[model samples]
Target: MTPSEYGFLKQFLKSRSGLVLSDEKQYLVESRLVPVTRRTGHKNLSALIADLGPRGSEDLKNTVVEAMTTNESFFFRDKTPFDHFRNTMLPNLLEGRRSQKRIRIWCAAASTGQEPYSLGMCLQEDRHKTAGFRFEILGTDISTEVLEKARTGVYSQFEVQRGLPIQMLLKYFTQQGELWQVSPELRAMVQWRKLNLLENFSHLGTYDIIYCRNVLIYFDQDTKRDVLQRLAKQIPEDGYLVLGAAETVVGLSDAFEPVPQHRGLYRPRKQGAAASPRLGSAFPTLKAMNS
Candidate 1:
């Protein structure tokens, strides 16, 4: 692609979805957009770009944005966070919200449903503790294609193999030919919807926990700070925020501080405390878990 063409496509993606693409990602753009070109009957990326003008079809623009959004996910990704949730976070939240008897969780960028489903399973395991609590899991993503798949709660054998414990799989999934379907009980626990991190989230109510995960890596620092600030507003004082093991809120936003002894866990910065300095440096031990 020529310089002008590359710049146009990069800026367009950034404006639409907050996806920051650098010059080195030119090959990635070509590879990802080739199918868009073919489907739209454009000869190449240039033609596709040329057609995406002020008069462009909304559907066409959405298609391009969706095509570029990464949707990689699997069951119980990065065992540590789930471990913390099951052992620490959930129990704490359960006790704190005992009076209210309600628990709400938002899993941002919940591609293919695994992350939220995993949380559902965790809740199931601890059902005895949450006997009377009402649990709600909302999984949101920018890609409608993945949201549809997530709602179906069906996965191929290969998808099940990744990060999914065999025991949990047997307990929660029913084999259907080559694919494994999440049990009705578990599937019913999660609600999936289309959400853009760049857009207003005031319509979505506050949550006791929010999992924004690996999605922030695609944005520039400004976008990251803005997104984190917005997310902070949706979390209550004692609520938790989980980012990808490789992502952080340290330099980006002071709205959150790393949870002590938790790899990828964070909470809203305390009201009267100083912001944690260089908190991202403390996450070296956490590995990237975006599979």
Candidate 2:
């Protein structure tokens, strides 16, 4: 892609959805968007962008953008967070939110739906604890197509094995030909929707726990800070925010501090702790929302 072409597409993408494509990822732009050429009846990449330049239908524009949005995800991608959630966080959050008897979990970048469903499956391990609570595992992503797959709760064997444990797999998934489908019970736990973190998610309100993992690394520092601040507004003081282990709120935003229980997991500061965001509205304190 030429610099001029890159600039045009970058602006279009950022405007439609808060995605930033660095120059180094120029190849990614070409490789991903090539499919759009064939789909849109264009002979090549340049033609696809050129044809879409004027009077492109809303659906076509959306298809182009959705194609650009990365939807790579696997069962548990990173093992540590699930481990932390299961052994430490879930126990604490369940204990703290015990009286409320309800919990809301948001998986911010729930690409193709595996992460949130994985959380649901992990929670499935302890059914008794969740007996009285209202558990709603909300999964959101910027890409509508991926959101659709998440709602379906079906997966191929390769998809199921990515981060799933064998025992859990046997317990919660069923084999149908070559594909593995998650039990309806686990699938029913999550609700899917389209949400962009770059935009204000304040309307969604506070959540006991949020999983916005692994998606921040692609953003510029300013964008990271803004998104984190906005996320803080929808969370309460005791709320838990989990980011990718490689990612951090450390110089990005001062709203949260790493929890001692799980080194990478964080809790929001009270009204005047350190550089906590003034707009902080933590939904609830959760040692873990395992149930």
Best-matching candidate per TM-score: 1
Minimal lDDT window, size 10, model 1: 282-291
Instruction: Compose the digit string of candidate 1's lDDT tens values, residues 1-291.
Output: 799999999999999999999899999989999988998899888888987889999899999999999988888887887876766677678778989999999999898899999999878876876799999999999988899999999999999999887878899999999999999999999999899999999799899999999999999999999999999999998888999989999888888888888888898888896444222221112123222
In every candidate, how many clashes are there? 0, 14
Candidate 2: misplaced stretches above 4 Å?
A: 51-55, 272-291
Instruction: Report the C-alpha displacement of residue 18, candidate 2, in angstroms.
Output: 2.7
Q: After superposition, how far is residue 4 of candidate 1 from its true place, in Å?
A: 0.7
lDDT per model, in order?
Answer: 0.87, 0.78
Assess candidate 1 and give its lDDT.
0.87
Query: lDDT: which candidate is best?
Result: 1
